[model samples]
Structures are given as structure tokens and as C-alpha cells.
Target: MNDHCNRCVGCTVQECRHHSDCEDFCTLDRVQIGTHEGNVTMDQCTDCKSFDRR
Candidate 1:
């Protein structure tokens, strides 16, 4: 991976519009992470609310 830009250490979400090709890193300054309201018990329940389409 290339240098970490913004706060992203690394990312594989190439579909995101803010994803950089150089390092496979997210260029966004920050990301919003959240969990579902009803019965959040596992890692699958968490979501990256800041993901935008390319």
C-alpha cells in the first residue's frame, strides 16, 4: 500500500468515490461508523455510514 492519506490506514472499498487508487485508501477526512438500532450483537451489524458511491 502507498502512504496513508487523511486518516485512512487502508481500504479495499474501491467502489467508493473517495477511494484512492494509489494506496487503496480512503481520501475522506473522516468516516461515520454506526450500528443498527435493533439488536446489534455482531460485527456485521456495524456499518460505514460515510460510504458514498462512485
Candidate 2:
């Protein structure tokens, strides 16, 4: 994992390639957030666009 992963916040996607195994933090300093365009209305509507398949 990169050293920057230590500063990650609220990361839960353990399957992502950028996610650290030990600390469970994301390596990216910034993560792209987005949502489907149909009927989004809550925080659950958002998704981490930065996710990459591990």
C-alpha cells in the first residue's frame, strides 16, 4: 500500500485495488463520487467512481 493510504477516511470497499489490507484505508488522496441518474435521493445514491477491481 502507498503511504498516503494512512489518511483515507470512511473507506469500506475492501475489494478495491487501492484499499490497504492492514489499515483498511484508501490510497488515493481524492476519490471521485457519483450516482446513477435515474432516481437518486440519498447518500446511498452516491458511489466511489475511483473504485478499481482488485
Candidate 3:
């Protein structure tokens, strides 16, 4: 399954926009682009709750 809330190791809040009061908002586990065997992977922006799609 594709998870999008896994926390990253040594994530610095200074560069994060949600660092003020939402550290967990900028963390992800994995991102799924298509359905495939062992094709699931995590991305840098997937976990970020503050990730603006604009």
C-alpha cells in the first residue's frame, strides 16, 4: 500500500514551512504512481502535509 505520512530521519524543521507547529505535516512514507509489484516507493514531498499542489 502507498503510505503518505511516514516521518523521515533527521528532518530539519528550519527549512520546512510547517515547522512552526506542524512537524508531522511534512513527513511521508511512500508514494504510488501506478499499480505494480514491489513498485511502491517514498518521495520527499509525499509526506509533507504543507505540500501545496499549486
Candidate 4:
């Protein structure tokens, strides 16, 4: 993807397929965010449902 195409979607997970190859960002137009907990109260409860292993 072009620099601008995914630059706005900041990320740090190196294992995600959508993560930029050369930058700390995601290459998807939109990302799916979800939770694994019934009653979430911490950041760890959230997840990037859009994630796909590289």
C-alpha cells in the first residue's frame, strides 16, 4: 500500500498481516475491533478482530 493509504491506521503488532511492511501502521481501510470478555474493564479485554497472521 502507498504511504498515505495506511499511514493513518497506527499499529505496533508485527505479526498482523495488515500491519505496514515498513511503517508502524495498518494497511486496511477499516479495522474490526472486538472484545473477548463479558464485562470488559481493561485494554487487554479488547482485540483487533481484523488481525490475520502474516
Compared with the true structure, what per-residue lDDT tens digits does model 1 show for residues 1-54?
Answer: 324466544677888777776766777778888987688888789877888888
| Per-residue C-alpha lDDT of model 4 across residues 1-54, encoded as one tens digit per residue | 425337667899989778877889888999989999999999999999999987
Report backbone clashes per prediction.
0, 0, 5, 0
* Colliding residue pairs in candidate 4: none
Alpha-carbon error at 22 in model 4, in Å? 0.8
Worst 10 residues of 3 by lDDT: 28-37
**Candidates 1 and 4: which is better by lDDT?**
4
What is the C-alpha lDDT profile of model 3 across 1-54, one tens digit per residue? Answer: 212334543344446433323443334443223333354465532343443332
Worst lDDT 10-window in candidate 1: 1-10
Higher-scoring candidate on TM-score, 1 or 3: 1
If both were scored by lDDT, which would come out higher, candidate 1 or candidate 3? 1
lDDT per model vs. reference: 0.73, 0.78, 0.39, 0.84
Highest TM-score model number: 4
Instruction: Using TM-score, rank the candidates from best to worst.
Output: 4, 2, 1, 3
Scanning candidate 2 in windows of ten residues, the lowest lDDT window is: 1-10
> Which residue pairs collide, candidate 1?
none
TM accuracy, model 3: 0.21
Selected candidate, larger TM-score, 3 vs 4: 4
Q: Write the per-residue lDDT of candidate 2 for residues 1-54, one digit (tens) a residue.
A: 544564646686889887877676888778888897578888888888999999
lDDT for 16 in candidate 1 is 78
Number of clashing residue pairs, candidate 3: 5
